[model samples]
Target chain A: MLRFIISLWASKLCLFLFKHTGRERDDRPGILALRLCPNFLDRVKKPPLVVAVTGTNGKTTISNLVSNILNLEGKKVAYNTWGANYKAGQARCLLDAVSIFNRPTKDAAVVEVDELLSYKTLPWIQPNYVIVTNICRDSIRRNAHQDLIFSRINQGVSKLPNATLILNADDPNSSFLGENNNKRFFAIADQHADVFETNVSDFPVCPKCGTVPVFNYRHYRAIGNFYCPNCGLKSKTGDFIGTKLDFDKREMLVKEKDGEFKYPLVSDTIFNAFNIMAIITLFRTIGYSPEVIAEHIKHIKLPENRVACEDLGKIKMYTFSAKGQNVSAASTVFEYLAKEPSKKELILLLDEHYGDDPNIETITWLYETDFEYLNNENIKKIIVAGQRYLDYKLRLRLAGIPVEKTVCVFDEQTIPDYVSTDGIESIYVLHDVTTVLRAKKIKDKIKEKITNQ
Target chain B: MKIEVLYPELSNLYGDYYNAKYLAMCIPDSQTVFTSNNDKPAFLSEKVDIICMGSMSERNQEFAIKHLMPYKDKIKELVDNGTFFLATGNSFEIFGDHIEDDGKKIECLGAIDFYSKRQMNDRRNCFFLGDFQTEKGEDIKIVGHKSQFSFSHGKATEKPFISVEGGFGINLDSKNEGVHYKNFFGTYILGPFIMLNPQFLKYLLRSMNLNDSLLYEEEINNAYADRLKRLQREGTEFLMGAE
Candidate 1:
């Protein structure tokens, strides 16, 4: 008890001091707390209603949407606004939720938990609702494979047998979590399901027969309607189904167990469509009315760090984040950029950054990404900048991209000098999360060059 | 040149299939034949210049071993006769004596003198920088990454594919990495092993009696030089977790 009080009060003091001192990156409080008391999470006071949103991707957007809806409904809610999804970040989130006296002040808390770290976070959070967005291939250093991550989540969910699991029926890899527990599913009948193609596929085999299940409708790698020919293992239908998605119209019709209702599409990307579906399913399962949820969702926009667009007269530049070492995320961004009808030039800044972590960066994930999408004739010149620019160039060459079409620069700031604004309608600056601020500066430099041109 | 990929549908884990794709790009007029688990491998029936296989899940590894058990002698003959075979990640384990996971042993094709022990609780993730000596006695620096649940044991130092300068090889404490018996080369290091090492790819092409001119030779060499400098830098971490 004394340890709990000391850890909590000490962390609370750290948060206070950090906030006053303008230490915007305040994960130190949680780290300090954990250092002082290893099991501080188990002893910390939590809100009566806690929801943990977790998956390989889309956890942040889903958790944010859920928390936004709850806040709009006049419930005092606490969530991790900064991108801290791990155990230390989660500890900091909980500390911020409670009063200085260590009593919970919020009515509810929506926590975004990392998939690999879920086994550690879920047991302590003891959430009433566990919303899983989807499971896909992530970094090999962090997430070895989907099987390992699935097992980790399974270990976490096993502790909370009564917690309702909100799953993505579209993802076969994640849909089967907590098989015996109560599960509510959300699915989207992808309009562009058949057109998906990629080199890296984390396809799931049938659990019973050990056969690779054939997909009836494959939206992208390992996602869609699948059925095993050997064991008759089939994909599950969702309790909440999103249909008639019109990307241009920015509208979708959602059918729930209660009734069918029209909701405004939050984003045009297929993954964002799934994110909205997961958010809707969670809100509806937790007794939020459809009308109220839709109203709040209409105001929520995709975080600029994920994707942002700027129109510099006739030349449009888009800053798209292709997460480092994440194959699916990079592939999605590449495919999306390739589908755009405008003549494009690509400025790739997708190098893994060496932060405080001691591990050497792995470059194997580059082969899995769909760099072939950039081989289209519409793409004029590809400018790659960073220490690993040659690695990307080699992968692109193997993808059948012409040698003359690619330009390599060791210095990222010099990328603008090689970018060709002539005969191209727009330039796409594809960047890694670590290089977002650098991407913005590159975009600004390109904007200046265009204005001077 | 013909490159036959064995059980690509099953062994296509961790993006190691790109090694085969890259080899094809380096070799002119090369045709790739992808043989699924249900289909018989083309190498078993025909003359192929190279046979490639990537990684797979442990469960699928069992299925792969079961499917290939009948051709153990054939695999041995091909390896002895200098048929170039490249197996990346744990696919190389399928050619070993056995794989011991959690006290249970799954017998593999005993073509090699090694066995693999798997620990479900511990996964080894690290960067591998090694010295690879080519057939012409030219020494080349080979760099790649290893992320796996199991590591091979027993007599791996007999003819290792590469000498480990950094990171763990085969197991936690082995400086000798992988197997290099005759023309068969198997290793856990795969940064799409071929794509990352252009000089090694050239050596591979030269050994296969093809024109060793690599596509984008200058850019690839520059990239390799940069990577080598970074890997050799003091305090650059080669291991992630406990050694």
Candidate 2:
């Protein structure tokens, strides 16, 4: 116990030093604590209720939403808001809530865990509920493929005999995790939206019979209500179902066995709707009333770091944090842009910045992404900037975008100057996670230029 | 010409389907048939000018081996007959003798002498720059990325598709990268290998007796040259083994 306290204090001191030294507050402290005391996570007293949100995407947003809602309901919560989601970061979040005596002061903790790190994290945290938003193909170098991530998560969840899993029934890869475990599912009903198929799909064949699964309707990119024709295997009937998503009104209806509830749509995108639905199901399971969830959720806006819009006089500027090396996330942003009924100019800053490394290999994730969405007629001009700008230009041209409309800049700093702000109602800046600060700087320059004009 | 992409739905794990797409772009009139795992490969019935297969999950690799095992003789016959076969990433491992995952060993098609062994926790990733001798007696530079959990072992009877100039080859110790049996070209390199290496693609085109150049030849070649130069400077610094 004495050794554990000493390690905890040392971690706190490290964090204090990091803050004072103007360094980013990350998982380094938690890692240091673990190094000092290998069983630091086990030594600390866990919160009364620990909910872990994990998956390939939406983990950060879901974790944030759950934490925000719980806080609104007057419950103290600890979460990793900086998007540090590995085991060390999770340990840091837990340590943040505890006193020096090692007793947790918070009532609950909403932790965002990386899919692969679940095996290292879940055993120590012993979360009461593990919400897997959805699992899909992520970065080829990091994730490999969806199946490998699924297996890792499965191995982790198998060790959690006391936890119930919250899964996405629409995602076959993630829903498969619910097998042989106490699990509840959340699914979005057929929205009747146009399903534009991509060249690749993560789950085209049925896991059980190795046959092509028959889909009643596809939401997007192999996520849908699917059943195997050979073995009669189908998507599990979700306990919580989101239906009648009215994007114009920004609202969706959630139906449970007992009754139906309406919640303000978090974002226009279906992915965000799924995140909202998952959080609702979690809050409902935790004994929060439907009215409380609906009311509080409206106040919880989407994170500005990811998706934010600002009006600079007549021109509306939008910024989306498209994760570098993630095709699905980038595709989602493009899809959202395509649906907007306005003439727009796009600024693509999708390069994974490897600071001062000129020899860094060009990422292949660009080819996997569907740049065809940017070929929409409404997009008047595209300004692609950064290290991988040439690669982006080539991909965009292959996707059938006209060379005249596309402009390439080698450096991100010149993006604002390159963007043509003429005869366009809105300007969209799509930046990667690592280059968000640069995106903001570019946006400011554009805003300044537009204001002067 | 007819190009058959075997089990594309299962095998297109990386952006490797772009290889087939680029091939189609380069040869506008050619029809590319994407064969699903459930259906029999089109190469079984009709004449296929080229057959391509890409990366896939380890579990799906097992399924692929099982699905292709029955047609092993046909594949061997096709290879001997000098039909062009391009297998990228882990897809090439399916044609090998066997794959050992953890403690379980699954038998492959045995089209090659080597065997693959996968370590669940150890995934090796690297940027490769190499040269291969074409049938025209010209050596061309090949640049591609490799991210895999498994590595192949054992001596290959035939010449390798690409010689290791920078990164680790077939295994950590071997300089031979992949197998080239007649017209069958197999490599662990991913990233739409043909698209990244235009010179290699041109060699492939020459082998097919096509006079056509690559689509966006200038840009593709420029990218290839730039990548090759960077790889030369880095000198295996970007090459990372299992963690």
Candidate 3:
């Protein structure tokens, strides 16, 4: 008890100092608290309902949505909304939820956790509900492959005996986790996107059989309605089905057990619909009424700085925070940009990491990314920035983009100077998680350049 | 000419399929056969100019070994006849003696003398900078990435493919990496080996009797040069630690 008090005091002091120093108190308080009390998490009084959101993508958005929806339902919720998903950040979130005496203040907690840190976080928190967004190929150096991540997540989930797993039915890799556990699935109905062969899909062969799985309709990459003809393996019908996507109206229809409900769309992308479905499924499973969820969904706002747009007089500039070392994420963003019916120039700041001494070396993920999307005729110029600009330029050229359309700038700071503002209607600044600040600065520079012109 | 990609569905991790894709780009008229794991490899029934396979997950590695075990003699014959073969990343482990994972051992094709052991916890990932010497005594710099959960052990009966100029080789102990049996080339390096190493790809094209001229030669060479320079300047600090 004394140790817990001392650790709590130390954590409070560290957080106070961090705020005074004007630093973002994301992980340091938790790190200090954990260091002071090695078993700090074990001693904390968890909220009545503890839910954890984890996966390769959509974790942050889904976690934030859960917190927002719960708050709208007049419930006190504690969550990691600052984009800190690791163990240290989770510790800080839990700390924030409690009083100085370490008693729970919130009715529930919606924590976002890093997939790799599941073993470290799950056993201690022992969440009542675990939501797994679809798992896919991620950073080559850190993640290696999807199987490695799947194993780690599975190992962590196995530690919790009573937790219900919320999975994506579209993904066979994640949906397979529900075989012998208390689980519910969420899926988007087939949009009938053209099914073509892609080398980037993580699951090609069926898990049950060695034969290639036939896709009824592939949404994008590997996520879709698929079944193995040889083994008769197929995706189970989702408990919550998202359909009738009206991107212009920014709304989608969710079909649950109690008739259909109209849910406000977070974004037009199919991934966002899946994220919404996951959140709705969780709340519904927890015995929340569909009427209440629909009422709360209207007020839900997506976390900012992921996708932003600014108008610079005649030039409209957009910035997308594409996850680094993730080929699928970047390819999705590029595909979104390709669909725009306007003359555009693109700035790619896709380096995995950044700093004065950034050790960004692995460029293999670039090959997996569909750079061919940028080969559209409307995209007049592509300015490749950061340390691996040469590699990006090579990939673009190899992807059939004309060499004349590509420009490489080794330093990211000089990006605005190279971006041609002439005749282009929009300039898209694509950045990774680590380089968000740099992207903002680049965006500012472009806006200034356009204003000056 | 037919370029056969063995089990592309399972073995295309780490974007290593681009090695074959880039090769086909260099030789536009070449026919590319993408064989699935359930089906027999095209190299068994038909004449194949180049055979390629890339990285896969650990479980898929075991399945690949089983799928190819039936055609061990055919693989041996292909290697003996000097058929051009390039196996990158974990796919190279399939040709080794055996792969041990969590105290269980799965026998590989045993085409090479060495055996591989998977370190599930310790995955070694690094930037590889090496020199591959051609028959004409010319040095071609090989620059790529290596992200693997396992490394090979034991002595190579013949010579290793490339001498490591930077990063860990075949295993942590040896500076020699991969196996260079006849025309069969296997390496742990991913990065779509051919895309990053234009000079090495030129040599490979020459060996295949295709036109030695590479597509996007200038851009590819520039990328390789920039990578090599960065690796030399950064040295070991840039190498990722195996966790």
Query: Best candidate per DockQ, number?
Result: 3
Docking quality (DockQ) for each candidate: 0.52, 0.56, 0.63
Error of 1 at B212 (Å): 2.7
Tens-digit lDDT track of model 3 for A1-453: 888889888897777787688865468999988888888887877999999998888888899889988888888997867778877788887887788888888999998878877777788888999999988878887777778778888888888889999999998788877345689988888877654345575786877666788888877788888889888999878988887778889888888777888888878777778888898899999998877887788888777667788888778898887776887788777777777678999988888644445464788888888888888888999998777777887888888898889888777888788888778899988888877778899899888878888
DockQ winner between 1 and 3, please give it: 3
lDDT of 3 by residue, B1-243 (tens): 899999888888878889998898889789999988878899888999889999888888777888999999888788788998999988988887898988999988887678888888888877888888888999888878887878888766236689888887988888887888888899999858888888888888888777899877887888888778777774455368643
Query: Stretches of candidate 1 above 4 Å error?
Result: A190-194, A354-360, A451-453, B134-136
Q: Tell how far residue A3 is off in model 1, in angstroms.
A: 0.1
TM-scores across all candidates?
0.95, 0.96, 0.95
- For model 2 chain A, the run of ten residues with the poorest summed lDDT: A353-362
Q: Write the per-residue lDDT of candidate 2 for residues A270-322, one digit (tens) a residue.
A: 88899888988888877788899999999898778788999977779999887
When just chain B is superposed on the true chain B, each candidate scores a TM-score of 0.95, 0.94, 0.95
Query: Cα deviation in Å at residue A373, candidate 2?
Result: 2.2
Cα lDDT tens digits, model 1, A156-230, are 999998899999998988998997789999888757654557776576467556676887887666778889998
Tens digit per residue, CA lDDT, model 1, B1-243: 899988877777778788887788767789999887777888877899999998777877888898899889998788889999899888999888999999899989888788999997888887889998986788989888888899888885456789999888877778878888877889998648887788888888888889999766886787788778889888878887622
**For all the models shown, what interface RMSD does each have?**
3.0, 2.2, 2.0
